[model samples]
Target: MIAYSVTVPKEYGYVILAATSTFFLNFWHGTRVGLFRRAAEIPYPHPYATAEQISSASPDKKQAMYLFNCAQRAHGNYLENHPSMVIAMLVSGLQYPRTAAVLGAAWAVFRIIYAVGYTRADKQEGKGRLAGSGFWLAQLAAFGLAGWVGVQMIMGQA
Candidate 1:
């Protein structure tokens, strides 16, 4: 077995903060979603408001649930992509901490935009495409950087 070591860059503090802030923001968003869930009267066990739940609700209830589902989805979307994005940021950070930090910050900002846009949209049409426009780009950048870093490491040029 071979053991490998990586030196933490001096600029790594920025990367640490960026990554930690993502978790902080995600947790905060979940707290807000919990409150929203209560306001919308969405009960436990149901991950989302089903079509039947929405259709059977009164107009006001329907609106509340729709909006709550939007919030939930926004949070859920963040969770879905979280593992890979964070992992890539950390992995790439080994060689390019500053770039990783910038990418991480961009991701955090875009995710916020996506969440807010999703929560405010009246309907599900396009799924907040406008708000999330920058999200995928940032995510891809982090992923790409991680792949490049791995390649360079393997080539013994990192």
Candidate 2:
């Protein structure tokens, strides 16, 4: 049998913590969204029912659908960005531990803000949504910076 090994820098400890924490938070949000769907009797396999079905349903069902949509969107957004963020954190932490940790932590916080804002808003666009969007941009910037630093280190330019 062939074996493969990988080495991670000691400084990556903090980065691991930050990445795991963010993952857990995203997982928590997804779990809550599942519960919301269950409570609404929206079925297990498809949490997002069609708009036509929601519009034709009873008032209570409609409200439940709305909440589910909001929660699902939050969960979906997290899932969409999580993998890239994790990769960036890991790579960057090898050379820039502090920055990676900070950015990861900030991303987690902003994700929560995004979920809360989307859940509470009657309309899709609101203060919380805007705030979350702003924070998300910052998180992306951090990731970009970290990636640049990691590249520089790899090239012996750092």
Best by the TM-score measure = 1
Worst 10 residues of 1 by lDDT: 121-130
lDDT, candidate 2, at 79: 88
lDDT of 2 by residue, 77-124 (tens): 888888888888877777677878888888888888888887774654
RMSD from true fold, candidate 2: 4.3
Off by over 4 Å in 1: 1-4, 121-126
Candidate 2, residue 121: how far the Cα is off, in Å = 4.9
**Model 1 Cα lDDT, one tens digit per residue, 1-158:** 43458899999888888899998988978997987798789899777788999899998888888888888878888899989999998999989999999999999998888887877746465366467669799899999999999898877788
Clashing pairs in 2: none
TM-score of every candidate: 0.91, 0.83
lDDT of each: 0.85, 0.77
Q: How good is model 1 by TM-score?
A: 0.91
Residue 118: error of model 2 in Å?
1.0
